[model samples]
Target: MRAWSGQWRPGEGFGEPLPAWDGPSTLVLVFASPAVIADDTPPDPGGPLAGLLEAYPASVVMGCSTAGEILGGTIDDATVSVAVAQFASTRLRLLTGPIGGGTDSAAVGRDLAARLVAAEPDLAGVFVLSDGLRANGAQLAQGLSDGCAGTAVITGGLAGDGDRFDHTWVLVDGRPRTGMVSVLGLSGPHVRVGHGAGGGWSILGPERLVTRAEGNVVHELDGQPALTLYRSYLGDRMGDTAASTLMFPLSVRAPEGRQGAVVRTVQALDESAQSLVFTGDVPQGSIARLLRANTGELVDGAGEAVRRADLVPGLPTLALVVSCVGRRAVLGQRTEDELEMVMSRLPADVHLAGFYSYGEISPIGEHTSGLLNQTLTVTTIQETAA
Candidate 1:
């Protein structure tokens, strides 16, 4: 397998250089800003991305707009990061579909997973990218696992719309649209995939009970309005809901299960409902707490995830890092610290492509992959002869 990665800047124009290779690319992944390609400013099928699409017209193209582009060891804003994969021994099956606002996330995931498995039961792994805001990350993972039925490994992330928390886009084939989910399945006897996820935020105070909740919305905590409880901690920072609340995300864990805690960021404040919305589910009766990041530890956590992945020996054909936007929020200009740490642990020859997502997706320990916030998730892939 072979891979090529490059960045496209707005003012740079399409005339700028792009990834160049001899053979045909099997898959094309793009992560750009919403401004670059949205339903409103529909990209000309023959526009900036034309060169890439033309180069590999047969390639399964999948990608989404991101909060920021993860290019190698740097975190870039207002840029497009592209990666093209040309596989020799591995085969890829592309599954593109719509995800209705009220559609059952598990059903969508199950359908996608079932379709891929039916087509190729020996599927090595599946990578997914969905509408971050409209879809339930947890339900989708559950559905994917159910469909795969422990037959394949699944990993991916939810598309991000910067910090605006409004209007995210996903690119299927060469067209970009909202309310769509795309999956790329890698199968055959040669594909070898490995993944790891970790969060560095430390728990604050004592764990509280999630007294009431609906899906991803938390109505109350410890028998009180969730927002009211959150503000009690924010104090002066309460006014700026968008940025300030990100510093202290909710740490959640199932009450009875031995599963690890997953941190969730406050997506929005529902004044009328008097609740807090998160990227994924916050089950009622679960244990919850506020988490604050220790910058140094956060960087260490990124490294830890890379070390844990134990990627295939030699060099990975592709390395994709899906990290949380909250990590970028806490790290600010220093956000590169996490990316740098993750990159340092990989072989220099591996093709790197990543993005800061609204929410990450990956399994933790014995658990199946799930939607996660404020965590760094790494996926590495390679192919060897059967």
Candidate 2:
């Protein structure tokens, strides 16, 4: 396998374009900050990506705007990270289609999953990137589980709009577009892929019973309005729930197996109904607990994610890091510390690429992949000797 990574600034131009490769190029991922994509100044994004696409026209290109981009070991803002790869023995296929705004998440996932199998029946794994603001990540993952039928490893995340969370873009065939889900399918006998998720947030206060909820919206918790309970915890920061509550996500333990509680960030507050909306589903009877994390714990969590992925000692052909934007919110100026910690555990030669997402998509236990928040999800890919 041959892989190359480069960084691009708004005016600095793309540092290095994808190198010319004779064989089939597997994939090209572009992670950029919102500022970079919205920049109107010189060296527009089109010119840089245009040149690369002309070179590797056959490569499947997909990505999204990020809170901060992970380019190798450095976490960058107001910049773009470009990673192109050519797998030695893996066959790659790309599928992308429209996802109706706030609706049809499961249908879209099922469609993508079916198309993936049709495209390559022996598909080994799948990576997804979708609109962060308008997609129901939990439903989409479930639909994928149903369609895949335990055949392929499903992983990826929802695109982020930085801290603003107003809008997000997903790259489909090198073009940035909204309300679209891009799925990349990897198939072949020699492709080795490993993934893991880690969120080192500590539970605060007792686990309150979710008294009333529907899908991802919780109307009440412990016999009180969900919003009221959330406000009680925030106190002075009640008015700024969008940004202030990122550090204090809800740790929800569903009314099922001992799979551990999955973290859920409060996406919005429905003041009229005194409800709280989350990025994923919060069953009516789930146990919801407040969660908090410090800078050190966040960084340590990233390292643990790296360890959990269990990558080979040397270097993988490509490594993608999908972390939650909430982690960035809490870390603030020290956000890069977490990325640095993850990089410290990887070999310098690994072609690393990723972004901060609204919700991470990876398996929480041994079976199905799930939509998670405040977690660092790592997926490493390499072509092992045939």
Q: Name the best candidate (by lDDT).
A: 1
Per-residue lDDT over 1-386 for candidate 1, one digit per residue giving the tens place of the 0 to 100 score? 77778888776753446555434337788898876666435566645566567766666778888988987898787778888787886778888778867898899999999999999978989999988777888888878878888777788988888888788878876777778888888988888888888788777778899999988899999999988888887688666464668778888988876677788888788887889988789999999999877789889889888887777777546889999988888888779988889889988887888898888878743636678888999988887755
Report clash pairs, candidate 1: none
Point out where model 2 deviates above 4 Å.
Answer: 38-46, 232-240, 258-260
What tens digits encode model 2's per-residue C-alpha lDDT throughout 231-333?
8876885575556688788998766755567899888888899899887899898888998888888888889887877666654568899998878778878
Cα TM-score of candidate 1: 0.91
Q: Give candidate 1 regions above 4 Å deviation.
A: 11-25, 40-42, 233-242, 270-274, 365-367
TM-score, model 2 to reference: 0.91
Model 1, position 300, has a per-residue lDDT of 88
